[model samples]
Target: MKECTGVGEMSEMGRLVLLGAPLGNPADASARFREVLATADVVAAEDTRRLTRLARDLDVTVPGRIVSYFEGNEERRTPELVEVLAAGYTIALVTDGGMPSVSDPGYRLVRAAIDAGFPVTAAPGPSAVTTALALSGLPCDRFCFEGFLPRTPAGRRSRLRALATEERTLVLFEAPHRIAGALADLAAAFGPDRPAALCRELTKTYEEVVRRPLGELAEWAAAGEPRGEITLVVAGAPPVPAARPDDDTLRAAVAEREAAGLSRRDAITEVATAYGLRRREVYTIVHT
Candidate 1:
């Protein structure tokens, strides 16, 4: 069997280490994360200030050069980071919280590094997605992570409508200020009775998780918007019961089939089989 190469094994070309920072608590950072931050040749952070604060909190010194790499600058910064990788200098990418490139600024650099033939790996750590899912008491067997909802109300509603029938549990991230409006729209689109949980400031000192129906959650948010990072876990849509065709519809089906060269008896059989009914039942309806 082929063996998996370790992240520490650096080739002539330096690797890109994707670091998953603590969701909120600095203590959640792993030992490998701290080591990478301390020893990497370059640390590309979504927010340099947050990275500095996190380093300070973890008692880790970032000896490498630090640079701002965010949404606004990702396109321009990716090439430079790749160039650093080409120079045999390991580049560690960290976001403000959680894993980078997860609705964060790390995709471009990852793609660039891979395309440039540089190795890319991660120092796995805490994530708000799984944290919120576990705390929500929702089924995690099958789920989807929708990083953030559309910024505009119309766009959000449109997106929600498309997902209304999704059977798998749904997870989403929302900004503090937009939490209220997002909840309201969720209730409107997914229906009031849909079960959901709201997770805030996960893994932090004042963390909160509220499990409620969409209606109650919307009402709660309307009363007062909760602060801090918001993660929403919503139950999937309930199974829709199949409706049996009525007398008029059954008659129409027989007539349509008869018009299509099927005999009345054959049409009744076809319609009965198609609608999962006995031939006698369809015949009575067709005759009556």
Candidate 2:
């Protein structure tokens, strides 16, 4: 909510528009994005230089003030932009590439404007997340985005462990250098045979999407690092085995643990560990 002054107010009817720039190629920018950039009273961009370059490439001179809007300065800039929106200025928000707020900075301003009751809208464009997901050959009807895995091995493993049971397809972003390590972690957590796709340099001249099992990809990535933006789409875990525990089975397990003087929690943990079953699944039977 940083304050910006001296910029004149907009008409009461002016609306705040979030424009999605192309991920790489300038020609990919939509006609609507060009029109809005040309006509808007203010252009807020993630990187001013890149925005100017894009405008130059589009051959469309932005007719208003161009301000830098990025992660470091978003907190300070959101309020100023909000004021512009409140004053009825047609402000066009764009990132260096792709839609703002997807993994970019437009979310703060957009959220602020929306909460303030200002009209906000978007001009759709290329999205790496969806593009990779679509090309992954996995179930896309239902999915979730887990942006950028944790950097530390321990943190990343814990994250993967938590998602090991996720039933919906999982989408993740990774740096080219870290792709191999990420795949290794995925293999360890989701099992080697889990299906996955490695999408690299999406939408560019050298764009490549390689689909394979997590373990194989990890082995391939070990030879050399791939280039460009990377998106990893991993298939979710298979449904858990649905076998019901018989009375004898549950009673036998309980008796063994009780004879060892183990607490109910400890017994359930051991039995679940031994049987490759979910702790909750084993606990349900023992408690029942």
Candidate 3:
């Protein structure tokens, strides 16, 4: 008999299950979610208190060992949880809201279980990412999920600048207190005219989706500190064809590039390609 930290380590067979929690509304809890919550042999959660509260709200009593498995202890608890799994028990993983391992805990334990050749499955439920995107009024055909922006203003701005030319729609998470600052940074990086939507308190009583250009959104958010969780969906960069450079413009640009350190031949080639003219023509211009 061995004692592992997280939950039941008494069994000899092991498997893992990740359960998605409701973001805001408890009624959104599904039947299967309730069943698993009540019957799991061992339950591990990002917040054990939240888990108990959820079970109470759902009118279900968890008949299993309850343990904490959140961010601060993921590294410490993964091995312990893995041991319980290796010991022939079913360990259910949950978070405060939404899918586990998505801007939440569960990845480490899942990875360790897989590496140990243990069975891993999930009870998929509500997700803020998909919910916000569906109501964002932006093209969802091709999009990217950017979980959360950097806390620092400068760091966030730098990250946004790198994504400036990204063509796919973007989904981002932000804290309530920092939403205004984040929106302002978005305006600077993506331009004031870029279209975007701010999703607030999704699936909750005060749920709201504000759609506007980046500039307007920044100004609106600045009015006051908004409450609740925030998700932002930004329209992809508009496709623009490179302009055909005129002869004079090409020559001037190439000269400027050369003065800035490009080789003469490279400068000629660069200008010719930009203007869709012959390299020999630019060579003639540079020489003559």
Candidate 4:
């Protein structure tokens, strides 16, 4: 019999399981989570201390080897864990809260494991993104999860401007300290009257969700930063009612685009697409 030397050997290949830690309450942890915590051969945690506390809270003893796998060490640690997995040891990857790799570490390891032909799976659990969206009262039917906005004011504004025309509800994670600035920038870019909700300390004691217009939320944050993990859900841009613009309107729209630095050809194409008219019609209107 040939010795199994690669991942194709089912009996010899180990698996990578991503465990989603509770957003706040330990009671939210599923039975499978506790089982994995107790039985995995090794556990890579974003915060080893938090894993210890979570195990204590859930009354599960993690007998496996525990190691820290955060942003600081993820790049350095992924190859090491892959070796462990190659050795047929079940490795459980977890973060302090919520799912790993959602604006958190674990993406690199997951990709690495897959590329190495190792089996990767996730024990799905609580997620702040979905939690905030469900409670936000915004249109959940069509939504986009933007893990976190750019940190600097200018970066944030630039990002918000790009998303200004999005028709899907927007969900974003933000730190408590920067929440105020984020909200203010959000209002400026998305418009002061845009509906939004600020979800804080979700699924934890002192949980608060403030549903208000963008401008109002900015003012509310200005008073004082609300503490705790924050998630923001903002309503998408309102639909533009159908209308046919006159030749003058088309010409003016094209001119506005040109003034904004778009070449005449590109501006005409944009205006034509926006008004559902032919490019030739817009070009004629612009020149005539």
Best by lDDT: 4
lDDT of 4: 0.90
Candidate 1 ranges beyond 4 A from true positions: 1-11, 242-288
**Residue-wise lDDT of candidate 1 within 1-288, one digit each (tens)?**
222234433346778899999999899999999999988878999999999999999999988899999999999888888888776778889999999888888988998888877778999988889989999999999999988999999999999999999989999999988988998898998999999999999989999999999999999988987999899999999767567888999999999999999999999999998877899999998888
Count of backbone clashes for each model? 0, 0, 7, 0
Off by over 4 Å in 2: 1-9, 245-288
Q: Model 4, range 1-288, lDDT digits (tens) per residue?
A: 232232222247788889989999999999989988888888999999989999999999888899999999899999999999888778899998999899989999999999998888888999999999999999999999988999998998999999999999999999989999999999988899999999999989889999999999999999988999999999999987569888888888888999999999999999888877889988877887
- Given candidate 1, what's the lDDT at residue 67? 98
Give stretches of model 4 more than 4 Å off: 1-11, 245-288
Winner by lDDT between candidate 3 and candidate 1: 1
Question: Which regions of candidate 3 fall more than 4 Å away from where they truly are?
Answer: 1-12, 242-288
| TM-score of each candidate structure, all chains considered together | 0.82, 0.79, 0.80, 0.82
**Evaluation by TM-score, superior candidate among 2 and 3:** 3
Identify the superior model by lDDT, candidate 3 or candidate 4. 4
lDDT of 3 by residue, 1-288 (tens): 433322334445576878989998999888878887877788999899989999999999999899999889999989998888766788889999899998889888888999998778888999989899999999999999989999999999999999988999999999988999999999998999999999999988999999999999999999977789898999989876577666677778888999999998999898788766789988887786
Pairs that collide, model 4: none
